[model samples]
Structures are given as structure tokens and as C-alpha cells.
Target: MKVLIVDDELNIREGLKKMITAFCPYVSEIGDTYGVQSGLEAIKKEQPDLVLLDVELEDGTGMDLLSSLDVIDFQLVFITAHNKYAIDAFKFSAIEFLLKPIDTDNLMHALDKAKKQIGNENLAEQLQILKQSLNAIRANDKKIVLKDINSIYFVKVSDIVRCESDGQYTQFHLSDSQKILISKSLKEYEKLLEPYGFIRPHHSHLINRHKIVRFDKTNGGTLLMETNCRIPVSHRKRAHILQVLDNQQ
Candidate 1:
């Protein structure tokens, strides 16, 4: 596959180019551009299969290039700094990103993900969803796209009542009493959903704070969700959870 690297920093572009050439055997050609305009030009000229883009460029941000692009047929993987807001935007959109001072393992992982999505039928729709989610900072204005082995679900963050860990998989309990079991671990969901008022009350459970009906102190603290599901709170996490709930109140 052909690849394009777009970043403002000279060393980053060169370093990434070297890494790709040395490690990524699947890549046939590698092209690079320093800023937004040149990156756009290179993309238009090369029409590469994948683009490794930087979020903040010299002239403009990567979002500018994404919005300005007339057609988007290639996969994208963003390179970003340790900016929480930008990370949140990426997370909500389910877009992949590599942090500053990039690691080879992470780069390889991101490239693999991008490669898998090269010929996705829903690529355009997913990009549109990403753009919308990035522009709207409010969690309520955003939607999450989840894919299981056989199906894809677009759901609001508010609709997720809780997530229960089932060994290597996570069972998502939604507002409509629907359960969707996904292959990702519960820890991944906890990080992604934490910004949207979801909390980990136990190692095996992540609950939406907005969906809590009551907290029972019967045989230890038990959380009653809006759906009437009772989730046990870990002894170690009980105080912290109670403090978080109190602060929210």
C-alpha cells in the first residue's frame, strides 16, 4: 500500500518515513508533506491508500484538511501531542492516533488498524461521524459507533447504562434492555466512556453515573441501575465512588 506522512515537524516526518520503510513491509511507496496545503496537494496527487497525519500543522490543523477534502477514500491515522481535548475528540470518533515521541509498537498497531479498514464500505460514513463528533464538544451531541463480529451499532453515550466484563469481552447493557457483547476488554471501555460520566465501580463493571437509580448499602454497597440491574461495588472503590456521586449531586 502507498502511504503519505503529513506533519509540520521535519524530524517527525523523516523519523516516521524511516520507521515505515524499515518496519512496514506492506508499504510500497512513502510520500510526505510538511503542512496542510502541501499535504492536501500530495494526497490529491498521490491518492495514497493511507495517510499518517498530524493533528496540528504549521498552517492549519488536520481537521481543516479533513473538512476540505473533496473526497475521502483512504484511511487516516492521526499523530498528536498529549492534548486531552484532542484525545477526547479522537476517542469519541473512534479514530486512531499516535502520541508525541512515537513508539514503534504503537505505530505498528495503528498501521495495522488502518490497513484493516482500507476498503471499508462505511469509511465515508465513519469519517462524517468523526467530523460531527469533533466539532460538537458536548457529549450529548456525539454518538459512538460499535462493531461486533456480525453487526454495527451507532449509539448515544447516554443510552449506555453499563458495561460488564465477560472475561476477554464486554457486555454492554443499553437503555432499551439490549445487550451487545463486544470483544474489547472492559478497561478500554472505561477509558473511552469516563469522559461521558461513566465510572468503574468494580474491576469487572463500568456503570453510567446518569443511569444510577440508587445505591444500596445492604450486604456492602450495591448500585441499582436505571434498568434495575444490581452491580456490586468493590470495597476499595466504594468510598471513591461515593465521593464522586456526592460531588455530582
Candidate 2:
């Protein structure tokens, strides 16, 4: 596979090239470019299969370069500095990214994932979600990209009624009765969704506060979800959950 590295810093570009050469056996040719304008030119000329794109450029941001292109046929892996908002956007979009001063293990993992999703038609959709999340003023306006083994789902945060932990996987119960099982841990999502009013009432369940129909005190404490499913509120969290519910009232 042909690859392109686009970054303004010469050292970053060179370091990435050396790593790719040493580790990525499938990469046949590698090209390098600086800034958005040159990066666009290189992409058009080289027609690379994969691109390691930096978020910021001298001329413009990487998103600007992508917007200029009518078609995105190449797999993408974004490189960004330690910016929380940008990281959150990437996470929401389910796109692969490597932090500044990249780690070899992380780079290898990102490349492997990019290689697996080479021909995925959902790239554009994922980029759109990323852009939207970055631009959105309200957290509820942001959409999350969830990928199961068979399908990718772009779901609104408000539509999620609850998430149930299943070993290493998390099952999302949506308001429209659609369920999506993602290959990620509930603990990972707990950190992402908690700011949006999702409460971890039990070790195995994360509940959306707005989606709770009622709090049933029977058999200890339980939450009646909007989907008519009953979720247990653990003894440890029962007091905190009740306090939150009371405050909401």
C-alpha cells in the first residue's frame, strides 16, 4: 500500500516515515508533504492508499484540505497534540488518531485499524460526525459513531436510553428500540457520557437520566426506562442516584 505523511514539522514527518519503513511491511511507497496546499497537491499526484494527516497546517487545518476534496478514497489517521476537545471529537467520531510525540505501539495499532478499514464507505460519514462534534456548541447536538463487527451506526446522544455492560462489550438501547452492541467496555463510555447526564446506577448498567420513566423503590431500587426495561440501581449508587434525581426535580 502507498502512504502519505502530511505535517508541517520536518522532524515529525521524518520520524513517522522511518517508523513506517521499519514496521509497516505492506507499505510499498511513502510520500511526505507540509501544509494543506502541498498536502493536497501530493494527494492528487500520489493517489496514496493511506494518509497520516496532522490536524494543524501552515496554510490551513487538515479539515480544510479534506473539505476541498470532492471524494475521499483513502484511509485516514489523524495526528494531533494533547488537546482534550480534539481528542473527544475523534472519540465521538470513532476515528483513529495518534497524539503528538507518538508512541510506536499506538502508531502500529492505528495503522492496523486503518488498514482493516481501507475500503470502508463510512469514512465520509465519520468525518462529518467529527466536524459536527468539533463545531457543536451543545453536547446533546453531538452524534457518536458506534461500530459493531457488521455495521457502523451514527447515533444521537439523546436517543440512547441506556447502555448495558456485557463483558468487554457495551450494548446501547436507543429510544427508537434499536440496539447496537459495540466492541468497547462500558467503563470507557462512562467517562464520555457522564457529562451528558448518563448515570452509572449499577456496575453493569449506565442509564440516561432523561430516559428514566420512573424510579421504583420495590426490590431495593430500580429505574423504569423509557423503553419499558427495568434496570437495577446498585446499593452503592442508590443514594447518589436518588440525590441526582431529586435535584433534577
Candidate 3:
């Protein structure tokens, strides 16, 4: 896969290029550049599968590049010298990071993680992360867009109670006693929402782990939800469903 290495320092840009060549044999093309301006130009030109971005740059910050982009359609792995910004990476769902003076071992580890995660190349998801990165400084939770014919609503991930699959679309149960229709398949929602705590309990149902009230472990297992709707735990998910619930407590 193509990889773009973006950092302000010449040493790091060269160091990581060598590390990728030595460790990640799967990497086909490597593009290296310094500063956010050149990095953005490189990104627009190559459109690589993965981006190893530094937090700081000469012309501007990496976050600035994120802000200016219409959509980020690549897997992002951050390389930074500051520990303070590291904590915020999780909020934006950054794949991994490298500290100052890159270590070969850590670089390999981070590359492995990126290769596995982005191998599938879900372009919708790539755009979603770009949207998320732009919203990092906000105090509110992350959101996803649902377009119905008349209206488009951005629903917060945290406010989701559960998702029920209809014939052609999925319905989102929210905490505010409102139901919204997302014109997308349940499988699509499953892949998108899995990063959060949403899991498939039945063929037609995806439950939010944070909203579970109780579970009955009998042959016909039942799930009591915080919304007061008791859902059935499918036979296939019985063992894993209970295990996840146990771990949650």
C-alpha cells in the first residue's frame, strides 16, 4: 500500500522512510515531505492509503491541514514530540503515534496496526475520520450523518440507544425519545458503529452496550434496555453477549 510520511524535521522524515522499507515490506510507494503546506500538496497529489503525520510543522500544524481539507480519505497515524496532544488522538481515532527520535520497533508496531485497519479501504469511513478530526476540540460527542429525502440530521454517537433494522434501512433509537431513520443498511451501520460500543445481538438488532439494563440467560434470553424495551438475545450471541455484559460490570 502507498504510505505518506509527513513531518517538519528532515531527520524524522528520512528515519521513518527507512523503518518502513526495512519492516513493512508490503508498503509499495513511500512519499516523504516536511511541513503541512508541502504535506497537503503531497496528499492531494498521491492520495496515499496511509498518512504518518507530525503534530507540528513549519508553515502550519497538522491539525491545520486537517481543518482545511474537505475530507480526509486516508488512514492517519500521528508522529509527534508532544505528550500533551497524545491524549486527544484517541478522540479523533488516530491509529497510533511515534514519540520524538523515532524507534524502529514502535514504528513497525504502528505500521502493522495501520496496514490491518486500512487494508479494507472503506472510503466512507475515511471521510468520517476527517470529519471527526475537525471536531476534536469541541466539548460534545462525535456525530454521524443520516440523509432522508427531506432532512439531514447529524446524530451524536453517545445519544444512540440501539439500532433496529427495517426492510431497507435502519432506525436509530435515541435517548430523547425520538426515532430517526438512517437510509443505510444494518451491516453498514455495524461496521461504522463498532468502534463505539454498538454490537450485533441479533440478526436484526444492534445494541448499544452503554444502554443495557439487564439480561436474562435462559434458553430464550431477554435483554432489558434502559429505554424499557426488552430485546431478545439471539442464540448465536448468547455466550459472547453474556461475556461482554460480564466484562462491562
Candidate 4:
């Protein structure tokens, strides 16, 4: 394991470094930063396995630094004089906080907890939350894949015209008349993509609301795609699908 120590005072940082090395044999590397500004840079560069961070810094607040971080994949130990910010740290099950003038016993306990919590959660959830919190969204990013011609093509959920079952293979239609065949069931992708703005108009079709140009409300409703791809609505799911589209409009 690699560790990064973030404290404004050199004395505090050095002392903490020795204590951690002496107690924890698993730590393979240690990086030190004197202030939150430098600490932020260190976090991005080093990407430590664990972070022992100070709440107060010479230039900025530790909590502010934490907020600015894309996501703390490491074990975060907030060492601060203030007790008020402890509430915020509690939200992440892995975070451990220690007061100033850290005690050996308290530090050991926090280390034990950090060891138990580190590297457990999957990376996807953290990445999504970090991207959302930073408010940096990539519009062209593809969140789903279409396995076609022995290669998986990553397609954005927004660009999808609709999905249709062609016997054993699934056909994905895009705005550019781009179609990909996946040797899987639509029901599988429905369970995966439907939660993210996809509506199932039929047992054989799944349409993206953002790409729907128009539709007929009559029985055997017709879905007119912006690119002139019209798909039939199945009687089984027609009511529920139109209701969902109505809710979106």
C-alpha cells in the first residue's frame, strides 16, 4: 500500500510518517504535502492507496480540498482540530477522522478501520458520482456497448434510435442508419438501459426518447424516428410505453 500524508506543518507530517511506517508494514510508499493546495496536486499525481489528510492548511481548508478532489479512492483519514466536520466524513463508510495532537491509540484504531474499508467498492459508482459532482459531463460518451462483427462498439445511450430483436440477434439502430447486431436478448439491455431514459415500446423494441421524432396514439402506434426509421409498437407494452413518453414530454 502507498500513503500520502497531508499536513501544513513539517513536524506533524514527519512524525505521522514515522508512526505509520513503524505500525503498518503494508505501506510501501509515503508521499508528503505541506498544504491543501500541494496536497491536491499530490493526490492527482501520486494516487496514493491511503491519505492521512489535515483539515486545516496554510492556504485552504482540508474539507474544501476534499470537495475539489475527483473522488477519494484511497482510505481517507481526516486529521483536524475541528469536530464539526466529522459529520460530513461519516457519510463515506471508509473515512476515518482523528483530532489534532493525534494519539497513538486513536491512530491505530483509525488505521484498523481504514484497512477494513479500503478498495472494496466497485470503481464505476465512484467514477459516476465524481463526474456528476464535478459537473463535467461528456455528451458523446457511450454508456452502453453493441457487440457487432466480433467487436464491441461503444454507443451512447442518447444516439440510439431503437433496439429490435431480429430472431436470435439484437439490432441497434442509430440516427445515421447505423445498425449493430448483438447475439443477446433485448430484455437484457432493457433491464440495463431502461433506467436511463430508454422506453420499451414493444417486446422487440426499445427506443430512446431523445431520438423519437413523432408517434401515433392509435392502436398499433407508429414511432417515427428523426432519421425516418419507423418501428412498430407491440400491444403488450403499448400503454405503458406511451404513458412513459407522455411523462417525458
Better lDDT candidate (1, 3): 1
**Which ranges of candidate 3 are over 4 A from the true structure?**
1-140
RMSD of 3: 10.8
Candidate 3 residue-wise lDDT, 1-249, digit = tens: 899988888888887888899889999999999887888899999999999988788888877777678877787787777645444554445446777878888888888887777745554454455434433323136688878778888888778888999977999888897898877889999998876777788989998787898887776798888899978888888888987777555
Estimate every model's Cα lDDT from 0 to 1: 0.86, 0.90, 0.78, 0.73
lDDT of 4 by residue, 1-249 (tens): 788999998988888888888887777898999887888899999998878887678888666777687666787777877544343333332346787788878887887777777885743344333323222122234467667767978787667778888877888887778888898888888887754556787777887766788888776887888888777888877888777677544
Off by over 4 Å in 1: 137-249
Candidate 4, superposed: residue stretches over 4 Å from native: 83-94, 120-249
Ranking of all predicted structures according to lDDT, beginning with the best and ending with the worst: 2, 1, 3, 4
What is the per-residue lDDT of model 1 for residues 1-249, given as tens digits with 9 covering 90 to 100? Answer: 999999999999899989988888999999999888999899999999999999889999887888798778899898989457757867766878899999998998999889998977776665655564554344565688888999999988878899999999999999999999999999998988886778999999999887898999878799999899999999999999998778555
Which predicted model would earn the best TM-score? 2
Please name the candidate that would achieve the greatest lDDT relative to the true structure: 2
Q: What would the TM-scores of all predictions be?
A: 0.54, 0.56, 0.48, 0.45
State the TM-score for model 3: 0.48
Q: Number of clashing pairs, model 4?
A: 0
Better of 1 and 2 by TM-score: 2
Per-residue error (Å), model 1, residue 56: 0.9
